[model samples]
Target: MEENFKMVAKTLFGFEEILAKELLQLGAQKIEKGVRSVSFYGDKGFMYKANLGLRTAIKILKPIHAFSVHNENDLYNAIYKMPWENYLSPKGTLAIDATVHSPLFKHSLFIAQKTKDAIVDKFRNTTGQRPNVDLKFPDIKINIHIDRHQCTVSLDASGESLHKRGYKTATNIAPINEVLAAGMILLSGWDGQCDFMDPMCGSGTILIEAAMIACNIPPNLMRKEFAFERWQDWDVDLFEKIEASLLNKTRDFHYKITGYDKAPSAIAKARENIKYARLEDFVHVQHEDFFKTRKGGHQKLHMVFNPPYGERLNIDMQDFYKNIGDTLKQNYPGTDAWFITSNLDALKHVGLRPSRKIQLYNAKLEARLVKYVMYEGSKKQKYMK
Candidate 1:
């Protein structure tokens, strides 16, 4: 039997709790949460399961070594002493990604270079040959983290970010990150119980993620690759078993999941993405300006999307936000409307107050994931002050 080891699942801001919950539900042991990360114990097959199943995780890392370092030499010496041959061949290609939160190491790039140098130098000294650096597609990807002089070197189990689920061949002007899209739906507390909609679905990322969530589908079932596939001990049979196990757990979703966009181009892109995901049966995309549309049914509706944050696409910030509020209040009754935007000023113009506002970051921009509940009956929209 394979022995269990510790692994860390990295996620975006405000998603640690949900990621932790996901790990727990997936049968992870001794789960611990960190800022934008969750650490837990699982065996090799479980690691395969995590990379395949975790929706919010950007990357899954297996920490191989941890030490205290104060200077560059210390970092190099630490990495050189490790048995890199166990994970990669001397002729294999390698890539290093580093994150520094310590005052001692000011440059993350330099650290990455130094780590890469140490590994290749070690290979050259021992085997008379060294691995080449291939940043794009490497046989091994390493992660270096320094926090308050404590350095940890980890093997990245997921090569590219898990967000590249291989289903999005097309995108609109401003497509939301797949990880963030999945996190938003999970945080909204929608579990396939009600109808789902993304009113301003740009390329239908939110809609696809929401539909996957509602159907209890593994987020990365359609992913092209995981870093572990190139490892020295890559177990094809074990990975297949894990994939089969996750697929068996998928549940059927009965409610409708839909998206609307004003632009015909966006509608076309959304349709393409939905089709790529093989979710055409469960999701529908339409060309309609959200501000001009009304709720179709009396069923409880769950809405989540990322509207224009006035960053890339050119749109009237204040007026667009006001229209969002007016449409929800006047038309979308019995609905829980949630949207994320970096435009703090524009949120005020929405007119309707948000019942919940959670702080998060959309890349470098500070953003808010706000929620507004519209009443079903005679009760007017309660604008929380």
Candidate 2:
């Protein structure tokens, strides 16, 4: 029988609860939610499943050591004592990623460098051969996290952030992160019971994520590789079994998933990405201005999108947001409109009071995920005026 061990799944700022719920649904035990991470207990197979199946997680880490360190020397000595040969070979490659919140360590890079020195020095002193650093692709990736006076060293289980879902071969100027898109869709409570649309589907990330959620498809199934694949204890047979198990659980989606973009280039890129995800059968993309379009059918529609926030684009954001409200009220009744934007000023011009507002962040920009419920029939008329 496999033994259960502790693992942490790191996520964006506002996704801790959503990620905890996802972990519970995935059969994790002793689940505890932190600020931007969740800790749980699971075996090796469960770890593989978490990396492959978790939609809201950005990366998973397996902690190997923890200690108190107030200075660089203490940090170096603590790391040097670890048995590195168990995880990496003397001739292999390695990479170190560090995050520090201590007054002692102001620079994360220096801490990473100090960690690398300790590991390499230990190898060189023992076998006269040390591992080389490979930032892009490494055999063993180490993570150092220092909070105040305590430090924890972990092995990164997912490489290159799980947001690199291997589906988006093309992107627009400001493409939404895949994990954020999935988290938004899940937070909006869209269970795929109705039609889904991304009115301003820049690169079709929301649409692709929605389709994956609707069908119960694992988001990382198409990913090229995970850091665990390079570990010494990697079990190809066990990984294959986990993959087959996840694939077998994918259910059929019944409703339609659609996308729209004003730019022809965006439409083309979205189409390319959707095809690459093999979600063309469930998603449709078109080159149409969302403000000039209307709801196609009477089915209860669920909308989620990442609209431009005037950061890079030179346009009148106030007028653009007004148009969004006008189109939703006049054309798209019986819909639940939800979107994320960092432009709080432009959000007021939407001209509709949101039923729910959740604070979030978009790449360091303070943002909000607002939901405006447009009721059907006469109730919709009240909000229209």
Candidate 3:
């Protein structure tokens, strides 16, 4: 029988609950949600399944050791004491990523360097050879997380952050992050039952993510590689079996998923990315400015988008936000419009009150996911909800 180990699935902020629910659905036990992460228990095969199946997760980490530390030398000594040979060979490659929120150690990079030094020193002292560092493509990726004085060292089982679903080959000036896009669509509770749209779509990220969710597709099926592919006990046959099982679970999709971008260049890039995801058939991208277009049909439209947030603060974001509200109220009735933006100062200009507002983060900037409900008529532009 395979052994069950603890694994942590990391995700973006505001996705912890959805990720926890996803873990529960994947047969993971002892599911626990944390801020921007979810912890669960699973075996090697379960780890493979989690990496292959979970759409909302950024990476799955398997913790190997935990200890108290207040100094750099303590961190290095603890790392050196671990059985590094059990995971990788002297000829193989390794990568270390450190995240620290400790008053004792303020620099994350310094901690990563110390951890790497410890691992290399252990190998050199024991076998006179050390594994090389390969940042882009490493055989094993290690995660060093320090919260206060306690540190947890774990093996990163999902490489490339899982957001690189190997689908996007092209992008525009403001293409949304895949993981964030997926989480937002899921949070909006849109399945394949109704029509969907990304009115101001920059590069069709929301559209592509919606199609995958609607079809019950494995988000990482198009991905080229995962960290487990380089593990010592990597079983290709087991992986294939897992992949086939996930493929078998994909259900049929029966809704129209569409996207529109004002710029012709953005439309072209969205088309290219959709093609790369092999979902061109399920999604349609067109060059159309959201403000100029009206609702195509009476069908309830599920809309999700990330409009331009003036990072330079040059444009009058207040006016752009007001336009967004005006366009939805006047043109897109009988629809639910949801979008994320970091421009809080401009939110007040939207005029229409949001029925639901959730706090989120876009990189370093604090953001909000706001929803406005449009009725079936133009005269009553105010949100019904």
Total clashing pairs for each candidate: 0, 0, 1
User: Per-prediction RMSD in angstroms?
Assistant: 2.2, 1.9, 2.2
After superposition of all CA atoms, the RMSD between model 3 and the true structure is 2.2
What is candidate 1's TM-score against the reference? 0.97
lDDT per residue for candidate 2 within 1-385, as digits (tens), equals 9999999999999999999999999999999999999999999999999999999999999999999998999999999999999999999999999999999989999999999999999999999999999998899899999999999999999988999999998999979999999999999999989999999998899999999999999999999899999999999999999999989999988999999999999999999999999999999999999988999777899999988999859999999999999999999988999999999999999999999999989999999999998887877486787
* Candidate 1 lDDT tens digits, 1-385: 9999999999999999999999999999999999999999999999999998999999999999999998999999999999898999989999999999998988999999999999989999999999999998999999999998899999999999998988998998768999999999999999999899999898999999998898889999998789999998899999999999999999989899989988999999999999999999999998998988999878899999899877877889999999999999999989999999999999999999799999988988999999999987645334441
True-vs-predicted CA distance for residue 140, candidate 2, Å: 0.5
Report the number of the highest-lDDT candidate.
2
How does candidate 2 fare on TM-score?
0.98
Worst 10 residues of 1 by lDDT: 376-385
Superior candidate under lDDT, 1 versus 2: 2
What lDDT does candidate 3 reach at residue 378? 53
Residue 320 lDDT, candidate 3, scale 0-100:
91
lDDT minimum window of 10 residues, candidate 3: 376-385
Model 3 residue pairs with clashes: 334-375
TM per candidate = 0.97, 0.98, 0.95
Candidate 2: worst-modelled 10 consecutive residues by lDDT = 374-383
Q: How do the residues 158-203 of candidate 3 rate in per-residue lDDT, one tens digit apiece?
A: 9888888888878877567889999999898887789999987777
lDDT of 2 at 228: 95
Candidate 2 lDDT for residue 238: 99
Badly placed stretches (over 4 Å) of model 1 are 380-385
